[model samples]
Target: MLQASDITYTYNGGLKLVFPNISCPTGQHWLLLGQSGSGKTTLLHLLAGLRTPTTGSVSIGGTDISKLRASRLDKFRGKNIGIVFQEPHFMRALNVEENLALTQSLSGQKVDKKKIHTLLDRLNIAHKLKSDTSALSQGEKQRVAIARALINDPVLILADEPTSALDDKNTREVISLLEEQATAAGATLLVVTHDNRLREQFPNQITL
Candidate 1:
């Protein structure tokens, strides 16, 4: 459901990063492996429609997002491309459910409290629904982040360094949750990270 081809980016200093082509089918999980400074983040941003590649195209369901105008791109991304950042960013004043409600609202989607609650329940963070984000444990907060990402039922899920700080067990758990949720939503999942241990977890991978 996701395809990125001949991707390249160039900075003002003339530094250029070229990425390997990636094609992930519907409901599949893929690990994008690379070391530090390997442009993994850059490629992730491109795939998420957050950054326009200097060359090539990124498509989901045959829609070449590189050609989308800014407004259209933002709208399309919010509706179809869900991103999980390495660190959780929350509105301190808002409770867990409130935060997720805001995500749906920002996406131009109706606030579906039932959907938000169901997602948190699945991620085991439903107990924190009314708790301030600051009051939650780091792990709980991370799970909330996952819940927010899946709330939109995006067509493609792009997770950047989702497991960089976790231990082996948590890493495995988080990866499984991502895959399970993606499958449930009928979305393609692509995790971009520098972690080598993931090489053993995903059957399909492309290294930068």
Candidate 2:
């Protein structure tokens, strides 16, 4: 479960963003919709512990991540939170398998090759395991991103602008894939997107 309350972030030059309180329970899927400059990505970063809010706390599974030291926060986020950025930034020198393996190692977990393969298989990206990430098509890369995000069996999955560049068919497929994988992992899912096409897809939604 995830809880964020009294969230306000201020950037330099006096830009301020105040986010609504969020309380998402385990296994639920929620969508966060906002227009450009609405701080959707900023809010996602706060919830994912990638950034600290200026005025609030974010709790995942009862731990106040904002209070964690950097080292501990890094390890905890790696293990408990899976983030799918709009751009999948894989290390250029690493193949899909190596990239995913690095994620496991970074989380202080043993590299589970079986887990890697199974996740790739489920995402239909098994054929790309040894392939360089740059060689993948857009959809393939997105699937691989999903595979990487699920490789650690994170308790919460945060996807930012996941379907912004996709057509209707691929958008639906990606959303379905995320939902299916999250359900299987027993993880709460939060998607931050500006796309109006997804408005009707999630009944539990927050619009900024």
Candidate 3:
């Protein structure tokens, strides 16, 4: 469902990072492994179309994202990709459900309350629906982010250091949740992290 061919990126004016060609089929799970500064997150951002690569192409479901206009790219990303970042970011003023509702609204899709509830229930955070984001604990907030990412039922799921803050139990729980949802939706899953503990969980790994 996603492909990155001969991708190269540079930052800080001179530093360059090159990645091997990577492709992910629907219902497949991939782990991007690298240390800090090794460009794992950069690769995830490139695949998500959040940042364009300096060279090469990224395509999702057969369309070349690099050639898309900025407006069209944004719309395409909203419809096709879901990303969970290392840090959970939310509108502090909004409750958890409101935050998700706003995301669906912006995506030009109606909110699917049943799906939202099911996602939260699966992540064990259904009770936080009425709570303000500020009141959630770190783990609860992360689960909320996962719920938001899955709310769109995106075709591709990209997670950057999603297990960074969790203990072993929570890490396993979150990983399992991501894999389960992605498989159910027939979505391609790519998780970027330095955590080798995840290796046993995801056998299809790309080491940078």
Q: Could you list the CA RMSD of all candidates, in the order they appear?
A: 0.9, 0.7, 1.2
lDDT of each: 0.90, 0.93, 0.89
lDDT of 2 at 86: 92
TM-score of 1: 0.97
Worst 10 residues of 1 by lDDT: 133-142
Model 1 clashing residue pairs (backbone): none
> Pick by lDDT: which candidate is best?
2
**Model 2 residue 92 lDDT score:** 94
Candidate 2: stretches off by over 4 Å: none
TM-score per model over all chains: 0.97, 0.98, 0.95
lDDT of 1 by residue, 1-208 (tens): 7998998999889999888888998888998888898888888998988899999999987899999988999889888888888998899889999999998998899999999988899998888899999998878978999988889889999999999989898889998999889888999999999998788989988888
Off by over 4 Å in 1: none
